[model samples]
Every structure is written in structure tokens, then in C-alpha cells.
Target chain A: MRNMLLLAQFEVKKMLFNPRGVIALAAFSLVWLLILLYPIRGASEFLISPDYKALIEGLFGPEVVSELFKWSVAELAIYWIAALYLFPLFSIFIAADQFSSDKARGTFRFLTLRASRESIFFGRFIGHMTIQTILVSLTVLATIVLAVSREATLLMPAIGSGALVIVNLVIVLLPYTALMAILSLYANSARQATIYAILIWAAMSITIAIINNYLPIISELKWILPGSQISLMINTQGLGSFAYAPVALLQTLVLLLLGRIYIKRSAI
Target chain B: MRLIECKDLSKSYGSKQALKQVDLTLDAGAPIALVGPNGAGKTTLFSLLCGYITPTTGEVSLLGHKPGDAALLGRVASLPQDATLDPNFDILTQLILFGTLQGFSKKEAKSEALRVLSLVDLAGSASQKPKSLSHGMAKRVAIAQSLIGSPEIVLLDEPTAGLDPANAKKIRELVRELSSKTTFIISSHNLDELEKLCGQVLYLELGQLTQSVSMDDSQQSQYLTLTMQQCDSEKLLNGVMELADISSIEKKQHNEFLIKHNSEEDYAIESALFTLFKQNSWQYKAILKGRTLEDKLFS
Candidate 1:
């Protein structure tokens, strides 16, 4: 327990001190600011015109705006969809350097002195999770504040959406974190791990889309992907639904198990 | 009791074996020097002792416990060859973190960190980040971190690699002072410094232990350079040779004769040689000589 705490403190210190972490937070804030400043006013018009409303209504049901609003805030469906790409990219960027950076800087030796390999691995994972959770939570809070301030009528809807977005983001981040931790342990270089992470993210995204269109039998496989599960949860207007909760939970467990195994078996 | 013991330890990276069937033992209170060239397996040996890397086919024990075991880790401190501090953290923070890992509570870690930073002469730079410090200062901070919990055994790998002479002298003095209560295994290419600090030495060559010698044996040679009248040279040399204690004599030049004595009998032989010079009415200019550990180590 002491070793784990020490290592976690060190990991947090590493992240806080990294210049890229500051940059990432700044980038996220800027994106949130832009979204709040410019609302997607013509989004419905471009995607579904009044003529197609009848067709859209048949598929989506009569209360389209109410359903859209509920889905948007209840599950943070739109934001979760966007985070599919954003969260994985963030995970790859934040965690790709966990082990490789330490190895490159020669800090692994220093870390090993205080803690065992197991403590180091799990400590770093927990620290990254904490940082991710805090960042996403802050972003949600900021967006809600901005949206409510812009129009009082959007307050409850914004608050609801923000809460769901945070939950979905946490779910989406878990597998990416696990995958990146594994990459950090397995890869010799940070660049190689990063490249591989990005490639895998892209491949998985494309594969999910293809499977969703062509193979109905294995379409459920899409829900197993880290970002896809969150996207489904967000679009379904059910934050506590079994469709999203059980699958995300299971995926998280599997990724974490595999990550721990890889780290334990690794050479350094 | 032995502070460290390794029996027929071996380790390999892929097809390249870094450490062969090596056996070593370190006692509780003696400071040992590990001297070796690059790739001589010095770091590998330290790693094995620290449990950073497991041995492929042997057993290593620290304080009678297996290496890397929780008990061993709690009692052992190591200053790795290329170990780096977190660039983002200040010196004090790093020290405190390492101390906590070594079983100190937060308050205890803070106080111990302060004490260790002072030992390494890094107390003033406690707030500076590692990236802001010079290479030597950073190395000193790393050393400070290892001394945190005051473990029973401290393994320092090239502890003075980047320090200037003055800093190196300070570190050597600190090690000397600490060795009374702490067992130290210091690895370095600096023979003279090692000689000054270590009571025992382990020399490695090509991943093998070539020699292990005690400092007492290394200090046995007594070579004296006597500057006297050219006429008295022959008489002095004869007097030195006649003494049973004199092992060998080498004539370096017209006036200088290198004298060797058996063990610590140099004082007796020197007194005799002076008596002979006094009887012969020899006029000597000056006599300058001392024991050189480097000579023993290299030769």
C-alpha cells in the first residue's frame, strides 16, 4: 500500500510536470469554448430537412427534438460520438509515454528502487485514470456553465447532458487507458507505441463501421470497442441501461486483465 | 552476517549473456568497491542484487532475504548507474517519494529527505527541478534519494561519475563517514577514489571476477625514493638489500633506488636504512615517497 501510494504520487508528479499535459488541457478547453460560442444551428436542416422529417419521424418517432434533446444530455450521445475519436487519441497521447519515457530518461531504475513492478504498473494506471477523470469532469462543468449562461432555458438540459457526457467519457477512457498501458509495457520506443496505438484506433473504428454495415451477425462486436460502447450508450438515452453498462464493464475488465498480464510478463 | 550473497548467478539478454556464473558475498560493515570497464557486467550485477532483473540461473540474497522481495527492498538502497529523477519534480519531492516507498511516513520522509539532502550537499537546491540542475547536481540528488531510509546496504553505481573533484571529495568523505554503520558497494572507474574509500575491492573483466583483494594487502608495498650523495647510493642500496625485510630493490636512476618491503615491515627497514646512512656519513638531499593503491590495482 505504501509502495503503491508512493508510485502513484510520482506518476501524478510526472503528468503535472509534463508540458504536454498543460497543452492538452488547454486544447480541450479551447475546443469546449468554441462549441459553446457557436451553436450547431443549421445541423438539423442540413442532415434532415423538413421534407425528410416525415421519414426521420417514422424511424426516430414523433418527438424528434424532445428525443434529440434527451439523448444529447441524458447519454451525451453527440458528445460521446465525438469522443470516440477524441478519447482514444487522447489516451494514446497521454499514456503512450508512460513506460517508454521513463526508460528513455533512465528513470525506471529510480522507480524500481522504491516499488516492485506490480506497484509501478498499477500505480501509473490509477494515476492516469485520475487525471483523465478530473480533466473530463472539468470540461463537462465548463461546458455546462457556458451553455447555461448563454441561454437560461438550456440550463437543465445542459446539466443533464454534461453529467451523462462525463460518465460516458469515463467508460470510453478505460479500455484506451488499458490498451495504452499494454502498449507502454510492450513497445521499445514511445514513437512506435504511439504509431501503433493510432493505427489500431483507426483500424478498429473502420472495422466496426464495416461490420455494422455488412455483417449483422457480429455487429455486437462494435459495442466491444472502447469508444464505440460509449457512443452507443450516449445515443441510446440510457445511461444506466444494460446494453451499455454491462458491455463497457466487461470490456474494461478484459482490457485491464490483459494489460496487467502483459506488464507482469514484460522485461522492464 | 553477510549483507549480500549471490551464488552462481547468471543473466542473459536474448543470446547475449550479461552476467556469467558469478558468486559474491558482502559482509555487514565493510565497504566494497566494484571496479570494471564498460560492459564488464557491473550494472548487471547491481541489478541482480537489487532485484531489478532476476537471475537466469542462480540465487541472490540481500540481508539473507531473496533479492526484490518486499523485505529486501525495504532494507536495501541502490544508486543506479543511469537512473534519472523525474524532470518535473523538485529534488525534495523526489527524495520524499523514495523515502515513503522505503517505509517512512510522510513526516518522517520529509525529515529524512532533509537529512539526506544535507548529506549529499543538496540541501540548498531542494526546490530545483531535475531538469534545471547540472548533470553533477542531478547525480547528487539521485544519490541523496538512495540514502533516504538509511538502509542496511547501499549500492552506488558510479556514484561520482559526473561530479567535479571538489564534489567527488565531499561524496567520498560522506561515504567514509557513513561506512562505519552502513555497508556500501560502490562501483566506479576511479581507482584512486575507490582506494581511499573502500576496504575491499572486487575487480571485473569481461563479465568475470578477475581479482578480489583486501586494502590491507594492497597497502603492503613500501617503495622509498632516497635522494643522497652519489657516493652513498651504493652503501644505502647495500644496507637496504642486507636487511631481511627488504623484498626487492630497483635502481631507477643514478641516485634513486626503489625499495620494496614484505608486508608492513617498511618502518623497520626504513629505520635500519637511515641508521646505515648515518654510520656511513652520507649527505642526503631529500626523501619523498608514499604507498600508491593505483599501483597495486593496475599492476
Candidate 2:
């Protein structure tokens, strides 16, 4: 357990201190700031306008707009929605090189000499998760600060909703980061791992669509995919937003186990 | 203590057999050399010992534990051939991380890293990134990591392959100095280096790993090599052959000969040869005590 934590700390240092890691963090910050600026800060008036409210209701129906408005503040709702999608994609990028480049350079040979392969694999997974968590929390805090500036009365409520948003976003990112963990084992570079992820996601979507069309009996298989619960998450509110937590957790568990198996059998 | 033990070990990759069924044992003592040609099983055996890969068949043990066991993490370490340090990290941080994983405290790990760096004469480069250093320096840093925690056994694959002679000699000196308290299994193609350092040699070829042979008795040689300073080849050969108990003499070069003789006739053979040389007024360059590792392995 101690060795595992030590290895995880090393991974965090790599992501935070390395030149490549600094560039990645910078890119994430710039894009995240733009997202916060345009959607929440710049469009606040349009979002709360009467006609826009009507437009949303007319487009999706009263249920989604009512569910969206159920949040403590308007900005928090926008931040929650944007974050659910943004963080997962960012996670795929940040965690793509978790093991691939290390394996290529033979650093794992050095690591495995002092730590077990399982420890190295899981420690890196935890490290990437920790990084994504920090990123998500910072963005959520920024949105909350924005909410407080618009309405001081909403601070307590915004904090509550911000906490919930952080939880939901973290759960959503679990499977995505775990997917990259398994992919890193097979790829020789981060680019190859990212490409493999896109290919897998595309191939699975097409396969699921074909199955749903031809074999309607097995349409339930779509839920097995990593992001399949996002559509359901869109209309849920409060604790209901956690409805898909079990599914995300299951996907993460399965991918992590498979990754552990691969690392054990590999020659690195 | 036993350093390594393998019984009928074999390893295969799909259809290719990298190591055949072989049994071997090594005990704690002087350094051991792993020598073989390219495509030999030298690296494969090193991997098996370090538990980087599992054997396809048979059993292997290090410090009385199975290879790759958690119990052996700090007890065994290796410098795998051509493996590099992660270029993204500075040398000290990587070494400290290795030390912590081996069960040292953070403070202890730092000091240990510095100590090993000094051992390799690389203390000043600790804060520099691996890419900024030359290949030889980087190789020395890699060797330093293998020294962390003062492991009971270290497997070095091509430890000095790319190093300049001076740097290579420093590493050789380091290994020699450390061998008193640690067991080293070094794999390399440099026979002269291996001959100077290793007390035992394990020859691997075509997936077959043989039993360990003493460096002094690699060929069980009762032969000696003689180098002379410009002597008449005919007179030298004839004079040496007339000595009692001398088995055979072959001229290896213009002034050198390989002489094989009875194992029991040590003093008599040498005294007679010296008397022959003195009579012919022959000036000698060197009289090697035993056949070279090259002769033992190839001759």
C-alpha cells in the first residue's frame, strides 16, 4: 500500500512538473477559461431572457427546462452540463500517456524493479484520476464564484450544487480515464492511444447502432458503453443526477481489472 | 546465501524458443559474467532472473523466493539492456522515487540517491534531465539506480556497452568494489572486461543456458600462452618441444606459441621452458598463466 502511494505520487509529479505535462495543463486551462467565459459569463443575459426560456421549453419540452431550472443558480446549471462533457474528453487526453511512453522508454523496467506491476498500473490510474479531480473542482469553484457575483443570496445553494456537480463529473470521468489506462498498455505512444480510443468509440457506436436496428432484442447492450448514460444524465436533477453512477462505476471496475490482467502478463 | 537457482527453465515467444530447458545455480560471492553471441539467451536469462517475464516451463528462485514475488522487490534489481531513464524526470527525483519504492524513507532515499550518484561520479548531474547528458553519463545514471537499497543481487545487461574506456573502467571498478557485499550478474560481449571482473561465467547460445564455469577453469585448460620479443620461430618451437612432459606446441603468431602440457608437470615444465629460452637467448614479452576467456569460450 505504501509503495503504491509512493508510485502514485511520482506519477502526479510527472504530470505536474514535466515540460509536456505543463503544456497539457496550460492547454486545458485556456480552453476551460474560454468555456467559462463565453457560456456562463458572456451569455448570462441571453440565457435568463424570457424568450430564451420559452425557446428551450418549446424545443425540448417543459420537463428539461424545468429540470435545468431546478438548480440553485443558472450559472451552476450551465457549468454542470458543460463540465460533464468537457472533463471526460480532457481526461482521455491527459491519461493517454499513462503507460505507453514509459513502456516504450523502458522506465517501467526501472519501476518494476522496486514496485510490483499491479502497483504501478493502479497507481498511475489513481494519479490521473487525482489530476482530473483537481481540474474539475477548480472549474466548479470558478463557476460558483461567478454565481456568487451575480447573486450573493445563492452562495449556499450554489456551493451545494457545485459539490454535486463535482461528484457527478468525477463519476462520469472514471470510465473514460480507465479506458485510456487499458489502451495505454497496447499503444506505443500517447497519440496512438488517443487514436485507438477514437477508433474504439466510433466502432462501438456503429456496432451498437447496427445491433439496435437489426436485433432489437439485444438493444440493451448500448448501456454497456462508457458514455451511454449521458443522455439520461441530461434530464435528471439533484440526487437523481447520480442515477448512472453505478453504471460508470461498473465500467471503470471492468476496464481496470482488464488492465491489471494485461500488466501482469506483459513482459515489461 | 543462494543468489539464484533454476531448474529446467524454458521460455518461448509464440513459435520462437528464446531459452531452452536448463538448470543452473549461483551462490553469493564474486561477480558472475553472462556471455554469449547476438541472439543468444543472455538477455532472456537476465529477464527471467529479474522476473520481468515468466518462464514457459520449470521453476526459478532468487533469494529463495520465486521470481517477481513482492518479497524480492528490494532484494533484487536489474539494469536491463538498452533501457533508458525517463527523459522527462531529473536524475535525483527518479532515483529517490526508486529508493522509496524499495522501502526507504524520503530523507533516506534522497541521501541514498546522492550516495549512489557519487559512486558513479555523477553527483553533480543529479538535477539535470536525462536528455541533457551524454549517452555515457545517462548509462552511468541508469547503473546508479540499480545500486539503490544496496540490493542483494543485481543483474546488469550491457552495463558498459556504450561507455568510453575511462568511464567503463570506472564502472568496472565500482562493480569490483561492491562485489564483496553484493552478488553481480553482468551480461556483456566484452570478454576482456568480463575476464578481469567475473569469477564465474555462464555461456548461453541458441536458447541453451549452460552451467556456470569458473573463470580460471573455463576450458579446464592445462595450456599456457607464450609471447616473445622477436625470436627465431623455428629454434623457439624446437627448443620448447624438447622439454620433458610437454604435450604439444603450436606457433600462434610470428613470436607467440600456445603450449599444452601435462596437468601434473607444473614446475618441471616451466623450469625446462625457461632453461630452453635462456639457452636460445630468447627475450620474452609475457607468459599468461591460463588460456584467455576468448580461448576458453571459442578455442
TM-score of each: 0.83, 0.96
Which lDDT tens digits does candidate 1 get at residues B236-298?
667778877777776666676667777464467667767877887777765645444455556
What are the lDDT figures for the candidates, one per model?
0.73, 0.87
Candidate 2 chain A — worst ten consecutive residues by lDDT sum? A40-49
Candidate 1 chain B least-lDDT 10 residues: B288-297
lDDT of 2 by residue, A1-268 (tens): 8887887787888888878889988988899889888897765656677798788889989976677766667887777677777777788888899999888988889988788889988899888888888888989898888878888998998888888888998899999999999998899999999999989989999999999999999999997889898867877767888988999999999999999999999887
Q: List the residue pairs that clash in candidate 1.
A: A73-A161, A77-A234
Q: What's the CA RMSD for each of the models?
A: 4.6, 1.9
lDDT of 1: 0.73
Task: Pick out the ten consecutive residues of candidate 1 chain A with the lowest summed lDDT.
Answer: A39-48
lDDT measured at residue B245 in model 1 versus the true structure, 0 to 100:
72
lDDT of 1 by residue, A1-268 (tens): 6677667766776666668667767887787656534443223233334565456567877664334443433223344445555666777777787687776676777767567777887888888887888877876676556545545676787786677667767776777787788887767777888888878878998998898899979888876676665434433554553456666667778887887776655555
Q: How much of the true A–B contact set does each candidate keep?
A: 0.53, 0.89
Off by over 4 Å in 2: B216-221, B253-255, B263-267
TM-score of chain A of each: 0.77, 0.96
Please give the TM-score for the first chain of candidate 2. 0.96
